[model samples]
Target: MMNSPVETIFYIIDETATILQEELSCTYLEAVAETGENLFQDDILQDEVSEVTKKRLQKSYEEANIGEQPNETIRKAFQFAILKGMKENVQPNHQMTPDSLGLFISFLVNKFITTEKQLTVLDPAIGTGNLLTTVLNQMANSNVHSIGVEIDEVLIKLAYVGANLQKHQLELFNQDSLEPLFIDPVDLVLSDLPIGYYPNDVRAQDYELQAKEGHSFAHHLFIEQSIKHTKGGGYLFFIVPNGLFESTQSQQLHEYLHKEVHIQGMLQLPTSLFKNEKAGKSILILQKKKEGIKPPKEILLATLPSLMKQSAVEDILAKIDGWIKQNK
Candidate 1:
């Protein structure tokens, strides 16, 4: 029932009965990275997702014009794969956790942007466009606009269709977020930044030895780099695991980030949030500001809920919304 990127972006998911994929792609450990496989082979996106699910999914992608995004490498392959899985009655969670999306939306709707009356957002790291899709659903055509950037060309194309389906005016770029990037000033910025894991190569030679300890130096560095363009006072959010978040051993890396940005809040997620083989996960929310007093150290943390559990997504969303409204 969704029509355009603006209309369909977040139209498909029902917070009550969201399913999850068992394993996220092991791109970091795999000898090779197959963006296509990860994009299409997701368990939840399979045939078991339901006709209503497929319809919502297709509507979201179509509205965004994500399929027609500026790259031929991406096609309807991801969509086809999801439906194919559904046809077989597969009900696994895939690359992302729809259950956690409500928490994120609560953050986006209230804390992240200056106002919900109007918004043009950006997600630099759009994997299969899940987070952005979730954000779109939360915004619900309330004059909230969006743009997403993804390194994987294939996913960008799939995201284009999903994003366009929501009636969002999206511009997908086939480029790494680390490189000099450009986009119009936006009110909100959300991303699952590229931690050193996941088949990253930017710091291979620079940090191969220290790879086991934490994210590469390049990733830590990129955090500061991306913040440069994020408008002052604009909200910024991303995930970093326990190894990185509470790393007394790796204090230098995150400490530098703490120094560079004014952290607004943080969500110390449980390890289960990352169904992938990765060590752990954490969610951070900060603001891009030119001048300001440091954010409180008592950074209120939202505990990471089970990403793959039989729970009500809206219940979680309501909890988050209550927090957001209170914060304002």
Candidate 2:
């Protein structure tokens, strides 16, 4: 038994993840990922358990004392634990997007993703769902819908808990995003595309990317897929590693993007933006091309300093708003 709900939630998640990993004979990351799927039955509630994994998951949830009531604080604790666990226990190569930057990107992207009906947002790599949730909350509209697909099991589960507690509806999937058969095209797409190369399997082959064999980064492949899944004239805002631009293999992708989409904006984020100082980041805002649409004469390009204050971000958003109006 734990003293507080926060402590209990964290302990249960950690212990369960570790136990599952040991039992399944996989990495700790794989175990953490499986924990979420095991807990949730229908993507919303914790009922409908599979017989094999039910005992372990039930014991953890019961120990945590997650009652019928949706405790917002507890849900937040769950999300925090997931983020913390990934940072401390997982390989140093993996990183979660910081909340400050997530909020900044969400608010900045919100201005351009407007719709008469509800705004539909899709995040291809919605680790823990913080970025998507933040974006939705800031939109200040009740009619918005968010869809996220993540490969990380634990992160997706934590994201589901957060959305449920906040009373927000979301479509989340714990599967390989590179697989065929995509969700309906959405009004806007937002994500922190994971960095690194993917095995050139059938899914990679299906993308038919212009890059040579073994050169495809998961981020670039997701960029292509996200563009394909976005409606014509819809917007996509993703954080990508800056090194991608300088790679020779990326030239083919650059050419394809030039032919297919409008480069609305690019922000060179400081290397210090993430915990890993060696990893440089940049924001890419692209608008899918409609049949008769032409690329804008001027694309907004700016560099953000290492330490950006909220006021400075507001100023940037103002400029982006002006650009959107001019282009529209």
Candidate 3:
């Protein structure tokens, strides 16, 4: 219940003990200690650690009231990093970042959504349940069945455990995301993707585009498939680097998106929220609109607040709620 980041981080270590063993393969004492040390060692992790604690203070987040907090976030990062550390197949460079995990949670809560009655949510790379757990937390304890396609069995197990801890009814499969998503009509929660320079099985059925992280590969295609499952006005949220906003190569995708999908909102998130030491990281919030309705002439553009701090998260939720209410 303490406000201090160190204390809050430790608090989550305590809160998730049972599930870590049962689901994510982390024993409380061992994993927590290991992760804290690794976080300190990694220069990228070190750079953001101070802002982490300061941001908690800035947000005035209630350690006790919030069902889950950033501490869980830090732990998930450790778990993912360590798991990657042990595996040669998955690169250590691109574990799902903690702050983006938090932002994913923010986007879900801000929407209060379940935007479509029939469509389900999916995460192809669901490394250790960062996105799924966040989605579970926002469901108001309701069972929203979601599917996670992860090549790592360990992460699939982690997602299973994390979902269970929150009592979220979910299905997790160890599969590659690039292959066709058989679970059609599913909206996606895309987090940190494998960038080109990073290590990943290039031969994996779903992998392509070596220049950028696997983040840009077939994402729009996935969006198109999601439309089959997504009802009109259903929302799709993806975390893409800043380059996507200004890239010349992406003009085709952007044009395709505007030509077909209705624009809901585009948010440029802060850089510190990233897991890796990279130049650009952002959250893209998109809404699936009905076919034939003219898309909004002016896309709603928001410069997202720093996700490291709690106040930033709450402020984002408040504004999004205001937007939905105004439109509704």
Candidate 4:
């Protein structure tokens, strides 16, 4: 049987990356980024690799014909390669958002912003760029400008090469997202918030959501940063901890949200998606406060059924659609 497009492309990515990994003495993810860049440029840019290895890589690239594949095919293929690399050397912060959740977020984004013909989207903690690209792929409008901020060098490189491979024209910044960003207000902000304490106390002090003492929660600072970069009344979608509002600093977060944004919805993700119940998270929809816009008459709250159950998921989505039609 012929290989599926995703399998074929993933095989090419894995094969080329393995060869590069052996040649460069680098980590699997680093080699994967190099492989993706080589594919995007249609040339073996690594001079360190032997002539034999270069020839092998070129053959794989030619056979794969990555440019002819659909954008989602390329994205998924690269995503598989990234997942493989993560398994080889796992970093807690290097995780990519699951495709199912990314797709659902895309649906919410489309429903909320149907009137906008052109939009700018920002992902403050872009990581592998999977979530942002997935959302972009599902959006109805093609005229979108995207910006991704990531602090890790290897992850950002992977994101960059992945964007090139998928032909997504996004601007990426390789720096701490908590620091000042030299970007204009964007139409939408999407992030899977990085959960941890931020080490930079001075920088944390700059954010309204910063903790009162000691190290601040990085996720809280990220929410404030994302909101700051979003235009008034623009939407911010976050994958947050289920207990996001139950922390010691919850009062401050509540105050900040009350002052700056209107809670649009909260959808508790299925516990089955995580390793355990404590690790489960939810999708939070917030719209930045503006002069005329008011809170939804009733927040769109739902506990999502397992994404594996298509009919149940669709039924819940239909209810969500009804809510959107009535409120949006």
Per candidate, the number of residue pairs that clash is 50, 2, 9, 0
| Higher-TM-score candidate of 2 and 3 | 2
Write the candidate numbers in order of decreasing lDDT.
4, 2, 3, 1
TM per candidate comes to: 0.59, 0.75, 0.61, 0.98
Any runs in candidate 3 off by more than 4 Å, and if so which? Answer: 1-90, 99-119, 187-192, 197-232, 275-278, 292-294, 307-319, 326-328
User: Considering only N, C-alpha and C atoms within 3 Å, which residue pairs clash in candidate 2?
Assistant: 33-153, 33-154
Residue 71 alpha-carbon offset, candidate 2, angstroms: 10
How do the residues 234-273 of candidate 2 rate in per-residue lDDT, one tens digit apiece?
8899998877678766787788798779988788886666
Tens digits of per-residue lDDT, candidate 1, 1-328, equal: 5354322312222111122231332222110112222223322244444666555545443434443442211223233343433444433312443445434554544544544577777777775575666666556536776777777654565566555544456778788665666777776777666655434554433432234454445446445555665676677776665556554436665555565566666666655555564656666777665676345545545665665554744565566566655654
How good is model 2 by TM-score? 0.75
- 1 versus 2: better lDDT goes to: 2
Pairs in clash, predicted candidate 3:
59-311, 178-206, 185-229, 194-213, 194-214, 195-213, 196-212, 196-213, 233-288
Scored against the true structure, residue 252 in model 4 reaches a CA lDDT of 94
Task: Write the candidate numbers in order of decreasing TM-score.
Answer: 4, 2, 3, 1
Off by over 4 Å in 1: 1-94, 97-99, 102-116, 197-215, 246-249, 276-278, 292-294, 307-328
